[model samples]
Target: MPTTRLSKVFPEELSEDTIHIIVQRPPRDLEFMPKNKRIRITEGWKPYKASNGKSVDLPPSWIGFLESAELEPDPRKAFDYLKNDLQAGDAINIPSMGQVPKDFGIHDQNHKVFVTEQMLELWEDMRGDKD
Candidate 1:
């Protein structure tokens, strides 16, 4: 069976000033945890600039949360508040994230999180009775 993969298609070349990336907290189900997680890229939603001169897609108030990265003495802890106290169904933002390589075919330079059969079963367990 072919493996599933994911990647981002950036609209333009990203620079440090233009975007803030956050590793998202994984969705939870019972006691099981997801092996992989995702990152949320905030580009101010692009083209629409808020008064603070940054773009906004999340809460307009969250712009401050994104910028709070600067307050963290330990760079890794940037956006710490969003991720620090999370419960099931709670999505939080993290400062740094990493990527894995592709599973098959040609080597995709882009990171690929190999979705295993076990992962699928976990999803089914989590989705139980939900619409």
Candidate 2:
């Protein structure tokens, strides 16, 4: 199940949809924000030369998506949606402890995700280690 955190909203100062997040560094997150294909983070972290100076582009919006993924309101219904709606590399991201791959069963991949081409593309698109 996923969780969402809320911050103080200064409605008078900004638009309702605008979110603000500040942190010392990005957390170890692929575990929380998996590279799913249906939704996307159009803008990712990158180096940019701005009018002020050079800086990095970082967005914490994935946190919203995480809470929405609680597997948030109803895990049972969310699981159902994944089972029925996922296709074309889409997957159900449940914590499958002691789960084994079919046929091989050679190794237990409790924390593995089904990697697809789309997932790969999404990974490259996101802000990565290199500039």
Candidate 3:
């Protein structure tokens, strides 16, 4: 009679397949706020002068779109929105807030803004699993 080793059965597999099986996590809970309901930050810019001493263009604003529907201007509120409000494919618009060039259309689509590793680590941390 031959005895089979448990190592032969498992072999302590450590591949992508094993990792995928071990790290199965639930889908992220997403919340979307209406575009008009969110707060928009109008950043300030400097004025430019031409050789004729005439102001060439107005300063541009760095628009920070917040996820809160309440239109709050606080940084912490903005951070909260960044963390909880928006998802991967959200759309953003500049809406000609400040001195941005008229030809520049700021309406853009959001890509994978939040990295997967961060979310994965967060999920693992929440589960109290350290691997």
lDDT at residue 19 of model 3 (Cα atoms): 29
Cα lDDT tens digits, model 1, 30-56, are 335433321223223333356688764
Q: For model 1, give the 10-residue run with minimal summed lDDT.
A: 37-46
| lDDT value, candidate 3, whole model | 0.41
RMSD of each: 26.2, 21.2, 23.2
What is the alpha-carbon lDDT for the whole of candidate 2? 0.46
Model 1 lDDT on a 0 to 1 scale: 0.44
lDDT of 3 by residue, 1-131 (tens): 22344344456854543323223355542324444333221233445655477764333422222222344434443333334444345543323222444445444532223335566457456756557
lDDT, each prediction: 0.44, 0.46, 0.41
Separately for all candidates shown, the number of backbone clashes (residues 3 or more apart, or on different chains) is: 1, 2, 1
Model 2 spans with C-alpha error above 4 angstroms: 1-109, 128-131
Model 2 RMSD in Å is 21.2
Misplaced by over 4 Å in model 1 are 1-109
By TM-score, how accurate is candidate 3? 0.17
